[model samples]
Target chain A: MNSTDQNAPLLEVRNLSKHFGAVRALNDFSMAVRPGEVVALAGDNGAGKTTLIKAISGVFQPTGGEILLGGQPVAFATPQEAREKGIETIYQDLALADNLSIGANIFLGREPMRKAFGFLPVLDRKAMAEAARETMKRLDFHVSRMNAPVSNFSGGQRQAVAIGRAVYWDAQILIMDEPTAALGVPEQRKVISLIHQLKAQGRGVIFISHNLQDIFAVSDRIVVLRRGVQAGERKISETNHDEVVKLMVGG
Target chain B: MTSTSPAQPAEKHVAPQADHGDPATSLIGRIAEGRAWLFLAGLIICFEIWSRVAFGATFVLNPFNLQSIAIFAVAPLLLATGQTFVIISGGIDLSLGFIMGLAAVIAAHATNMAGAAIPLPLAMLAGILAAVIVAGVPGVINGLLISRLRVPPFIGTLGMFGVARGVAFLLAGGTTVPVRNSWFALLGNGRFYGVPYLVLIAAVFVIVMHYLLSQTRFGQHNYAIGANVQAARRAGIDIRGHILRLYVLSAMCAGLGGALYAARFTAGAAQAGEPLLLDSVAAVVIGGASLFGGSGTILGTVAGALVIAVIQYGLVFVNVEPFWQFIAVGVVIIISVLIDQAQRRFSGGRQDE
Candidate 1:
């Protein structure tokens, strides 16, 4: 459905492998995401979906293989490096400080500072508040108190705040790990709509979910993993839930 | 994908007021945040009434009584300032008390040696500098143990507490080390513009600390770390480095408190801050900082310290037994914690809705 599907891959993995001692958590896994496209990563428990995402997001180094971004081979030593290169990962646990305001959550590590009295540096609070307002507005999410701590928000709103953080930083590729797993039915739909919004903005999204229905709804293509390797890859239009489930379990 | 419009909805403007429909909760929230000041005001009023009824004298209006109370607050307030940062970071520095004692003993010896070779003002400065720097030794070790070795903060700091206490007593040669420097005594006892010089110094230090904890990036990161360390790590914050620096800063505060203690008493005692540790922690908690971390203010701690000082001084001023002061402070701490728990439940309930 993405008009820019013909565009060069925003993030590409070639024969990526990650091993932990005697265990081959992910082996020779490969995937590609293009601009304005949504790629669903679906697999059963312990199927190596987490390993593949973690490796791509720079949480762990691959035992073998290469990652290419924008057609150039690259490697990230840390998650911060990945983020700096426009690869943002939203974990299922949600990396948000519950006691902090949405704006504070948005700029946790990378706080913007303004000079006070033309010399001493201080937090630019006005800028943070304004950014929170604009970012949430851009996400089509509305909350009464922009300054309220994210803890007071519902699961869907908290998910939006995390996405808004990625959006505010202008991440080109988003890897969401089970983002809709814990949300209510309505909240899951809201998250799916948010993914659509991300696609409309020409950003690449790699959505990981257990729900085959959610994957079918938002993703253009699904990449299924089984036992640390690529199980099958299929276009949404060319496949159905039965076939995807078969790929997840293997034969 | 369909083109998703990014325009704001008309109803978006109405969201703020709609969520605030419960004005009573908002009012309670505001009061909770400022409860430290409220408690202090209430304490003062009670004391004022008691003084009028029982002693036929003024409690708050007397300049001497006010000065004595401010002096009483000084050491505890300084120790509490450091404790405030540590507590906000979701850690405790149990060694702060002995660290202050170690610095006090070191300051006395350093000042005596420096006085023999240097001018009076320079000697005083040298002593204070030496004490603060030396006090950072245990702090560095504390940081290393807790951050690098992955030891629990409580256990690590408790170990350091013993280490510092033993070292302080050893350095003091099992007795108080007397300082012969007149300048040190002047700094401790002298008054400027109707205020003690020590009080002025403390006021300035507290103001600077308030800025550090409220206006700076370090302060914000501190809150983030305390609120959720996993989130902070995910955000790319340098946790180990920050923890190391944080301990050093905390120790330096205790060091300054120790140096001031030596100046005030004109001697360095191994037990200089032994009794103040409890007071410092109590001040931070009474100020509304959650022991679990992520919530506290330096100003609130200021009010908390004043509350304790007033309780101690007011009780003595009213001819009440000094032992009752402990009971009164304990009661206030319980009351403050109860208020914190109630506020937490109130806000926590809204998350589900």
Candidate 2:
């Protein structure tokens, strides 16, 4: 491994731990995510990938250890607070309102409002639609229309919308959990391309996936978590899929 | 080489994939897509035919009869509007009838205590406040249990149903409380420009609700939470607060409806809105709102209420037995539910295929 110490990472975790009753979901795990980088998190089922993500995303507060963002010690009591601090997570389910239009889903909670005559406020649907179109275009996503309900969109298109939502909200650190899971080959390709696009935009991405091909394709580095602890970190150039799998199994 | 470009073959496949050939034109297709509106239209037509032909024809388009329909429909309209939010969020509030009853009793009692010297508006306000408070309690409980404790909404609201009804009976001493305020009657019985105040209030509430549900951030969150709660949570939505407010708003509306009912009748009877519970659920179902959550409209619920009211008036106009009106409502509810199920199944099949 090339040991190069550069500028501080965007996110750093030290001895982060969590216990669900008698079950130890995460234990003394540590990692760093630098800006403009994609770090793939791989582990076997029940290896605490979700727990670690939940801890970082503020879904489940860690029972111990500290999390620092931009080298400043911070704690998030709620996911909303975490989001405000630019830590956004996209779960495997995508967490989108399928009945809403793509534009609506993209701006679900924090919608832009237009002030007409200084008092009467209205939703800026046109502006939102335009932004959605632009964002999707930037990602090379060819959705036919922004007005269509998200339920009608294919899986790849929906993921694009989800990612667009997080990115549009100015999320500096993006944590995507199994984004390509349950998708077809073409859909997986679309998501991989989008991830690369996000990296190109200078955002730090923590990608969780079991597919090694996907990990090797988009990740700048791989962080394997074996049974709630960081097994090791491997640079994309220095490590092959087999070595990463071995580390994932704590070899 | 030019003829064998890879983009040409990909483009060919794209055209066929995009043109899945208009599923909207097929028999099951139209039903799956447009059944909600179709059911609403069909109900109106049935009521129109029955009110005009079966009845002695004197009631058709008559102002007095129209006013009666409005008065009869207002309670259900208010109840269904509240139910619309609850159902769209994939929950049910069966305690609405009891909550309404409690509100009626409280309003009547408060209005009477305010004495003859008090102005009618203040008395009305008192009643509204009382009902809002009583209704809000069950809502808070429902919200806490459903959101915080993770209790099933049905079980939570059902328990509230018993508690609220018992409170109503207890407060009223199991008897009717007569409202003596003359001005309070004006709200229920008075008319402005030929429109009954009762109908006008119902109209305003429906319009406000329609805008809130269709155009606001709150409405978006409601649908998101209803369609999938975990997804909503992951999206950083405050699910607990939203559900709490949803149930509170629903109960508050029911409370307001109860106050309106008390004004219309000049008496608060414990049993006044008992039948409304079933009718409200029926109206919501008939209006094409999904009980499973994530789909509904105020317009649909309004139409559903009108359909029910028209049926009731038609039965009275035709001099049919009172019990027959009950049977008719039951049949309507059953038919509406079946249509809803069929539409859901048809849509599900299409999505799977």
Output the number of the TM-score-best candidate. Answer: 1
- Chain B TM-score of every predicted model: 0.95, 0.88
Model 2 Cα lDDT, one tens digit per residue, A70-150: 888889888888998989998788888887777778787777777757875667788888988888777667665567567
Where does model 2 exceed 4 Å of error?
A: A1-8, A13-30, A46-48, A60-68, A71-74, A115-122, A228-232, B1-40, B47-59, B345-353
Docking class of 1: acceptable
List-wise, what DockQ does each model earn? Answer: 0.45, 0.23
In order, the Cα lDDT scores of the candidates are: 0.90, 0.80
Clashes (backbone N, CA, C under 3 Å), per candidate, total: 0, 0
lDDT of 2 at A136: 74
For candidate 2, write residues B149-238 as lDDT tens digits. 989999998999999889999999999998888878888799999999988988888888987887677877888877878777766678
Say which docking band candidate 2 falls in. acceptable
Candidate 2, DockQ score (0 to 1): 0.23
Worst 10 residues of 1 chain B by lDDT: B8-17
Tens digits of per-residue lDDT for model 1 on A166-209? 99999989999999989987778778878877887878899999
